[model samples]
Target: MILDRQLLLSNAQALTTGTVFSTNTIDLASARDIGIGDNLELFIRVIAPLTGGTSVQFAYVTSANADLSSPSIIVQTPPVPAASLVAGSEWLRVQVPALSDTTSRQRYIGVQYTINGTFTVGTVTAGLTLDREGLAVYPSGLNTAGF
Candidate 1:
């Protein structure tokens, strides 16, 4: 059976236009204690015109805090060719095996990117899917339900 524990790693946020680097992190769980054989899928959507030379990286980490000193990279797609991100033509999706020999104490997923040139105008969003064997229920207005 498919689990309904879907999580949003990054909201639909506008990319900064220009040569600037930025990182966005979404703490999935303080202590997921994820077990072996579990899977994680990352979905990335970018509104085209993503400006050429722009680089983006997706990763996940297990830490007591949100500091991503070290992270497990899921995927890093090639930079878009200069002026190649025509409108309506940029998107990526990757599946990751979240298996670990040992249980995790915390699980944090995020994305980092550098806008190398002027992106006409666009937004970036990231989502994560956890495959397990149970359903998750949440209380209203409580963002900490993922913990």
Candidate 2:
């Protein structure tokens, strides 16, 4: 899959303790539409195994400031086990929040990593995509993609 730099959040970033902001933040100061049947999505994958951490989470946040000094979380992925943080593991494949009021949204759009505990090693890459790959997921994990 081709990743767009503009929409990319983290690019194989090795994260430790604390929060890690995206290399690039989307600026939405003007009115814009994501288009019908489309949603801004995040694709986060692990490039290295994580150790010394209890768990980690991925979140979609919006802020009035470019530095995301104070972020308002729109959505987030479930906290995955630290042991599950292995190379080639996909952390999150989720849709952006369904927003109708642009005026109510913040001026900046970005992502953040909130580590639960101390982490000596962790790496991940994330990006946004408007095009969804295919039919996937079940309401209750019946079977991964089971109907």
Candidate 3:
């Protein structure tokens, strides 16, 4: 068994008020072909000095292309608390639910966030963890083979 944890978004991403930040799109089919299983989870962390009425939310989006349109929010965190911002890093973890039977199912997956109101300088990061099941063969010494 192999474990794969991919960082979809790094810490360099800055939040913009009234704007949305989206991570790179992931090709689920290719990921599965490369031994990534259907079971997946998202880990999100945010650090910011947010004032009252300032809110942040995380969601999963599926699109045919990188330019997402009419996106559907699969899962999201509750609005960030104004007091929590001063406490420390706000974290959220969610499991990806079963996909639909349509062609868009498991096609492209990505993380997106929306920020509102005034926010102090901060960074956000998100990652996807995939559990790979099966033997990892290697043609060369110490190197794992493709699934």
Candidate 4:
């Protein structure tokens, strides 16, 4: 759950009707190449409590242009309930697909949010992370203890 500013997409962005592109777009062709390789995850958290809204849809987009005009959708999340969006909670997490993933990636990577209904109060913060260790802690099977 480590957040990096350089990899940040949105910063407490206020959700409104229509679509809004993230403030930052990551350039994979650059020297840093933040979102590349086989395993990468984008973490989104609700920095401000959401109220008076129907839902919001999140998606990662890629494009050769920095403006992200008519960008190809990389991956998207289903519409999320406004009630579930609270401060200090995860709104959504997107796993950066490989170059050969279902959608595929471009030279630049960015994020976008679409507000479905009227949102009187809502904001989100997002960024990419290199760690997947946090997701591997779930215990899904019974332990074999000399059974």
What RMSD does each model have against the real structure?
13.6, 6.3, 12.0, 4.5
* Model 4 error, position 136 (Å): 11
How close to the true structure is residue 26 of candidate 2, measured as C-alpha lDDT? 74
Clashes by residue pair, model 2: none
* lDDT per residue as tens, model 3, 1-147: 233444464344566576464555666656345324566666665645545447777677676655455566667777775556543463556666666666447466676777767665666666665642236576776556674
Model 3 lDDT, residue 146, Cα: 75
lDDT of 2 at 17: 78
- Give per-residue CA lDDT, model 4, range 15-110, as digits (tens): 877787888888877897564453678877888887887888888888877877778987788998887778977755767667665346677778
Candidate 2 lDDT, 111-147, residue by residue in tens: 7888888889778888888766555666783566644
Sort by lDDT, top down from the best = 4, 2, 3, 1
Please give the CA lDDT of all the candidate structures.
Answer: 0.49, 0.77, 0.59, 0.78
Which number leads on TM-score?
4
Q: Which candidate is the best by lDDT?
A: 4
TM-score of each: 0.52, 0.76, 0.65, 0.78
Which whole-number lDDT from 0 to 100 does residue 89 have in model 4? 71
Model 3's TM-score against the true structure: 0.65
